[model samples]
Structures are given as C-alpha cells and as structure tokens.
Target: MDRITKLTSEKPVIIFSKSSCCMCHTIKTLFNGFGVNPNVHELDEIPGGREVEQALLRIGCNPSVPAVFIGGELVGGANEVMSLHLSRSLIPMLKKAGALWV
Candidate 1:
C-alpha cells in the first residue's frame, strides 16, 4: 500500500498493469490517445510484482491489473475509465490532474 502510494505520487497519471492483459493494453492505449503520458508499471515484469498486485487487491481492485491512479488517486479499471470517457468526464479529469493540457 505504501509502495503503491509512493509510485503514484511521482506522476500525474499512473497505471499498474500486467504485460499480457488485453484490458490493460486497451486502457494504456486510451490514455496515450488522450496525449497523457501516464507512468506505466508492468507488474508482471518487475520485481516484487506479486506483492504489488496483492496490495492493489487490498485497495479494491478486483482484477488487479490496469489499476489507474490520476493525481495520486485511484480512478479504477477499464470499465470505470470507459464509463468516465463516455460521460465526457475523463478529459476534464485528465486536464485537472495535469496529465493533459488540452
């Protein structure tokens, strides 16, 4: 939990992902499309990844991968992100987080 907080604190947008998760890929692509250069941590490829994943689970990420933090806050997974996008709230959130300028 503390580790997750530290990681997220360093960036405007952060994504905790698994290398082979398609949904993770989609979410990352979505952020990139919005011109938000999110800091991506591929949990499957990093040391202590499983522990980080467990921490994510404790924080209420069901599937665990693709956990997104915007301005150091959890914005949830693909579904929540897509919902925000469909509601036209995602762009404004990104802008407010300083992840996107336009």
Candidate 2:
C-alpha cells in the first residue's frame, strides 16, 4: 500500500498495469490520445506485484490490470474510464487532477 500511495501521490495520473495486458495497452493509448502521459507501473515487471495486486483488492478492486488512479483516488478499470470519457466527464477529472493543462 505504501508504494501505491507513493505513486498515486507523486503522479497526477497513475496506471497500475501489466505489460502484456492488451487492456492495459488500450488504456495507455486512450490516455495518450487524450494527450495525457500517465505514469505507468508495470506490475509484472516489478518486484512486489503480487502484494500490490492484493492491496488493490483490499481496496475493493478486482485483481485487474490498468487500474487507473487520478489525484490519488481510484478511478476503476478500462470500462469505467471509457464510460467517463464517453460521458465527457473524463476531461474535467483529468483537469482537476492536474493531468491536463488544456
């Protein structure tokens, strides 16, 4: 949890992902398309991936890749992100989180 906390606090947009996950890639691409360079943490490449997965679950998320966080708060998975984006709610969240300047 400490590592997760540190990451979320340090970056306006942090994506907990797995390098081999297609959904993770899609989410990253989505952010890129939106002109936001999110801080990506490739869990499978990290040392404490399992622990981190457990930690995410403890916070009520399923053990899934591309767990998005903005302004130090969990924003759910890719589908949630897509929903937000489609609803036009994503930009405001990004701006509020300081992940977008324009």
Candidate 3:
C-alpha cells in the first residue's frame, strides 16, 4: 500500500487500471489528447493489486477496471470519465486541481 500513499496527495487525477480494458486505454488516450498528466496506477503492477481490492471494499464497486478519481473524489468507472470528458467538465476539474491551464 506504499504506492497508494504515493498516489495520495500527489496528483489531481488518478486512474487505477488493468491492461486489458479498452475503456481504460481510451481514458488514457483521452487524457493524453487533452495534454493532461493523469497518474495511472495499473492494478496488475501493484502487490497482488490488493490496493484495488481494498478500494472496491471501500467504494462498493465490483473491482471494475479504470477506477478514476479526481481531486481525491471517486469519479467512477470509464463511462463516467468519458462523460466528463465529453461534457468538458474534466478540463475544469483539472484546472481546479492545478492539473491544467485554463
């Protein structure tokens, strides 16, 4: 869970993911397209990915890939992330967190 600590208080956006999710890849591509430096924590790389397991316990979400958080607020799965991006809310949120300019 040390990596979890690194994630906490470190970035405005954090994406918890697995390698196989198309939505996860899309979200990463979306962030890149926006020039946002979203911190990605691949669950596969974490110890047992137990951190994701714990997050599921806390959030009550069933271990879905691409668990995204913004300013430490759990923003939910990929569709929600894409919705935010589509509505242009993601950029404002990033700006609020100093993760983006304007």
Candidate 4:
C-alpha cells in the first residue's frame, strides 16, 4: 500500500516484476523498446518481497507480478499493456508520463 505508493512515486514509470516470469520479461522489453527507462523491482529477489507481493494482491493485481505504474498510476499487467499498445495508446501515455521523449 504505502510502500507501493512510495516506490511508484520515485519514478516516471515503475514495473513490479519477478525475475523468471516470462510475461514480466515481455512487458519490460516493451517499455525498453519504447525508450522508457522504468524502475524495475524484482520482487522475487528482494527483501520483504512476499509481503510486497501480498500488498499487490490486496490492491487487485491477480497474478501480481508485472504490475506497472505509469506516472504513479497502475496501468495493469501484460494483457492491459498489450491492449494499450495495439490501440496505439501506449506510446502517448508514456510520453505524457515523461517516460518517453518521442
């Protein structure tokens, strides 16, 4: 909750991820491809990770990993990200969030 908020606020784009989740990898790659240097927290490898994961769950992230925050707001998981991309809304959002320069 508070911790998540704090973490999300520290960056223009933030991705809460797991080290081995393929979907997480894909989402990260997508952001990188767009030139957005998101702050990534590998929950599986960090201290208090399980508790952070639980917090994510309580906040409505079903699978939890790959939770993305853009401009300090949750943009959801892989599916949502891909949907936004397909709709051509992702890059604009990234630009608005100051995550992308172009």
* Highest lDDT against the true fold, candidate: 1
Per-prediction backbone clash count: 0, 0, 0, 0
Query: Candidate 1: RMSD over Cα atoms?
Result: 0.5
lDDT of 4 at 34: 80
- The total of clashing pairs for model 1 equals 0
Write one digit per residue (lDDT tens) for candidate 3, span 1-102: 455545746888888887777888988888888788888887777776866557555665455677777787778788887888789887888888777884
The residue-level lDDT of candidate 1 at 45 comes to: 95
Q: Write the per-residue lDDT of candidate 1 for residues 1-102, one digit (tens) a residue.
A: 999999999999999999999999999999999899999999999999999999999999988988999999999999999999999999999999999997
Better of 2 and 3 by TM-score: 2
Best candidate per TM-score, number?
1
Q: Give the Cα-based TM-score of candidate 3 against the true structure.
A: 0.81
TM-score of each: 0.98, 0.94, 0.81, 0.98
Model 2 agreement with the true structure over 1-102: per-residue lDDT tens digits: 898898889989999999999989999999999999999999899899888888888886775677999999999998899999999999999999999999
Please list the residue runs of candidate 3 whose C-alpha ends up more than 4 Å from where it truly belongs after superposition: 1-6
Q: Which consecutive 10 residues in model 4 have the weakest lDDT in total?
A: 93-102
Give all candidates' CA lDDT scores: 0.95, 0.90, 0.76, 0.94
Q: After superposition, how far is residue 53 of candidate 3 from its true place, in Å?
A: 2.9
Q: Lowest-lDDT window of 10 residues in candidate 1?
A: 93-102
- List the candidates ranked by TM-score, beginning with the highest: 1, 4, 2, 3
Alpha-carbon shift of residue 23 in model 4 (angstroms): 0.3
lDDT measured at residue 71 in model 3 versus the true structure, 0 to 100: 84
Off by over 4 Å in 1: none
- Residue 60 in model 4: lDDT: 91
Residue 77, model 3, lDDT: 80
